[model samples]
Target: MLLPRSYINISFFQPPAFLLIGIPGLEAAHGWISIPFSSMYAVALTGNCLILLAITRTPSLHQPMYYFLSMLALTDVSLTLSTLPTTLAVLWFDHQSIGFNTCLVQMFFLHTFSVVESSVLLAMSFDRFLAISNPLRYAAILTNNVIIRIGIVIVTRATVSIFPVPFLLKRLNFCPNKTLLSHSFCFHPDVMRRACDDITINILYGLYVVASTASIDSLLIALSYALILRTVLGLASPRERVRALNTCVSHILAVLVFYIPAIGMSIIHRFGKHLSPIVHVLVAYVYLLVPPVLNPIIYSVKSKPIREAMLKVLRKKGQGS
Candidate 1:
């Protein structure tokens, strides 16, 4: 009987369709392209860390908006920390052969952070919705107790929603080909496709989770923004209108950057396998990881107060030396 090592070697010899895209006969070159992704992640990590530091060190930014922004920064950091190292390791060492346990841990954290991010965005949307829809009650509505409760709910919802995915994936057995996952990490759907068993349950469950959590969050966020727009439009002063709209502008942009590609990839990966794997992988990174880097920069560069706070903190540190 052929050993598992021989089977792995045989599987490695037979590359998937994704490996032949660019450069003829350059299957190994696929790993090289991932370096850019690593660099992007590193930049994102630095930016998020700086934003968190700026927020925590400066007392002037103790308002609710900045507090939410701090939470946003922390979420971004969590997301980057979760995925980037494993991806970079896979790319660098050519170590695509993840053990069953390691893959499960990766999948767990990946989905957990993803769901957390969606929940965070939902919370931010609600924050903006309250601030704009009822300015008089914004303070009363988003008090310390309320914010803490919302934070707990966001964490709990994300944790609970994604717990089943890794558990379900743990029972699957891979056969025929476990070598080529196409993407950097063991994405749930990609891993499911490798299972030797009937995957009808996996597919159905994936669809259910996607529709219920991500799709629902996106819809609610859109509705909130729509109401927010209507409220902002009715304001008498242009300044008030801009101020109200501006509060959500960063979040809206963040939501768009995060959700659009995510929903697109979920559909494409599910229904449109005919598309190029490189395109699919690129889109996945953009959706899954890019926003963590982009969100802080957007808010810092666009919002004068954050930028000023960052600058002030930098200057004080410089002067204290």
Candidate 2:
């Protein structure tokens, strides 16, 4: 008589629920969403490209506010280009097995652009705060030299801060079963779990990155807005206060769209493992990928000047055609 199969054989026969189902087909849903998302990205890319061109081509937009706006547009473009191709490929092919190197590159670009975006937003907030809070010194304080220095800081800080993540991730030893990433892209935390080595250093570094970039930037943004609000209140005209608030509304909405789900994803991935992997991945992309598509539309539609400028550009192109 044949002997009973070993415990290992028995365990192999009944795998974990995740192992059985694999990463759920949520990425397939991303295909359906990709149509609208692609459209949004296309518009955003075009609009931002135009903004950059207009600012560079036009002498009048050489001021600090427009300079910051140009930087914001560039950041938005970077955000789109970083994730859109990989996302589209995953949706198109139904393939989830990303090569280790490719995954790391994607993660690096994603994090780098994300950090840069946050920094640009913070810079924009400070610019607006200064413009409104101290109108007289605004021109003096935000001179071209000062703006250029700040731009360098934004690029340098973001690049330096996120460089360690990919470097540390390269040292991880991933198990065979861990090869399949659950999402469209390689997210740091999700990939880290697959490591066969101690992740304490990685975890600590991640926490440091979050604290230094996201948390600190958010606090500074809030403080800037607070000062802005106080300054707006002092304005004698209710119309002026409303106009000031309106100018900030786009940035406020953009920040909320970008950060809330990001922080939530970080929280749930760390503490709420009981939740579905599919749900987690969905939340991750919605935060990481969605706002870049949403921002241009929101800003262009809400801000009359931008909307008018876009329309004028389009009209001119149409006439030339």
Candidate 3:
């Protein structure tokens, strides 16, 4: 509850707790800032949950696209939930102190969900690729059983990949009495750097995981779109081209919304020496926050079935009122 206090290892102590400052440089404004952040989170929760509900209730949305959209909705909720409580607690309630185990748990969930979301996006891209490039075989390729299997593979990939990180971190000793997190959360890099031991393995392992998962996924998604574009361009009718590209609009925006901030944050972390801590924190937060806040809105606007289902629900409620 209190800010994490500095401790000495003179006596036998349990795992050390770390402080979670909401916005490091703007401590005085954390209260005011939480208002907008909380509003975004509220919208994100409402939108994503409604998407899941609409997809479930609407039999027409039983197709692959809507199924993937539902998975994205679920992952968005998971992503929002992974860090929202602790982040808000730090900002609103000044509950900045968190134990080692708690921090590890939070970090694992945050990173795992992120990995899962990336995997889901990759899977969705593959779905689009199949639908566009091989229309005749689309249904055969992306049947319910296949989608279910993809979902299982996604969860398994993320869970297995992230399972070792916290344990890897736990093996290291934080010789320093107190270590501060950059954002209002425990980041893997920040946690790894806190240790006095040789962290080459930590850094290397983290890079390997990112390279194998997120980087590879992004590259493959790009290839998928490139192929999709080639296919779309070959179509004779302008309307067909427009319609095909229109279907990809939401996905492209989703990918850009996710990757741009993510890439920016990474760039800033690596090279933006002039940038302040506030920039890093905000960028990092936005990388996670913006996707959830935008995904449902994008889907509802771009996908006709979802839009109609949403309007239908609204009309039913209006008539009831």
Candidate 4:
């Protein structure tokens, strides 16, 4: 008995789903691998939630810097949650099938939060520069109204920029039986590569989004820091200079944690074709997982105000319990 022609055509053009590979060569070690990943996800969730709670609860933490930090924490929580379901499912249950539309939804949120995180980091750098460069007007410059507007713009820009991606992807016809995604999550590049149709438009649009968003944000962030250093150098008191730079160390760490792995993963995907599949998958995990897991810890350890607020929050919780 042969299958119907229309059914065959439909299956060819519209694949039922895509297969996600947890870790290509380490299938046997998946159980062991899930331990660390699950732990990191838990940390990312708890830490970011605590940071948000601390910021929202403490009246003293209502400054522009803390506002931006709260935004960052929120973005981290979103980024972590976006990948957690699919990643854990693959690792814990070996459930690899993801519907085509579902894959697109996952890809949208993952990349959207990533871009929002990048933008928030840039905004935080600007906050630092203003605080160090012009302390007198810092509050005036980044008033609550201004911060709110910036937050809106950050989210709107990310959503609008990434909105076209799914539509573009929908137009392409994926290769038959070639729907194996590289990572446990759906990535734009990985999904695009599966298309049997011409993906020139998709590639160009993807590059455009990256260059306009993350690349520009990175350059501006570096410039902001450079000006901050110059301003710090001009101060007569060595102690003042030390204090100023100390304020930036945490933000610098946060930026590095977010960007280094992210850029490394992009480079690996584009240029490290000769490298093993495990290398690509591992780097991808680092890019998605490390920043969210570490950002809260970095801030809590380095920022006294946040640490105190978090402590207060914990104490309150303990008493309530």
Model 2: CA > 4 A from native: 1-23, 26-34
- Whichever of 2 and 4 has more TM-score, that candidate is 4
Give the Å error, residue 131, model 2. 0.8
* Stretch of 10 with least lDDT, candidate 2: 13-22
Over 1-321, each residue of candidate 4 has an lDDT whose tens digit, in order, gives 343467557744856788899999888899999999999999999999999999999999999999999999999999999999999999999999999999999999999999999999999999999999999999988988999999999999999999999999999988766878999999999999999888999999999999999999999999999999999999999999999999999999999999999899889988999999999999999999999899999999999999999999999999999
Best-matching candidate per TM-score: 4
Q: What is the full ranking by TM-score, best candidate first?
A: 4, 3, 1, 2
Against the reference, the lDDT scores of all candidates come to 0.75, 0.76, 0.86, 0.93
Model 3 agreement with the true structure over 152-261: per-residue lDDT tens digits:
99999999999999999988867455467787888898778778778899889898888989999999999999999999999999999998888888988888888898
Number of colliding residue pairs in each model: 0, 0, 0, 0
Query: What's the C-alpha lDDT at position 259 in model 4?
Result: 93
Candidate 4 backbone collisions, by pair = none
Q: What is the RMSD of candidate 1?
A: 4.4
Ten residues in sequence with the least summed lDDT for candidate 4: 1-10
lDDT of 2 by residue, 112-195 (tens): 888888888899899889888888899999999999999999989988988888778777655434455666677788777777
Looking at model 3, the pairs that clash are none
Ranking by lDDT: 4, 3, 2, 1
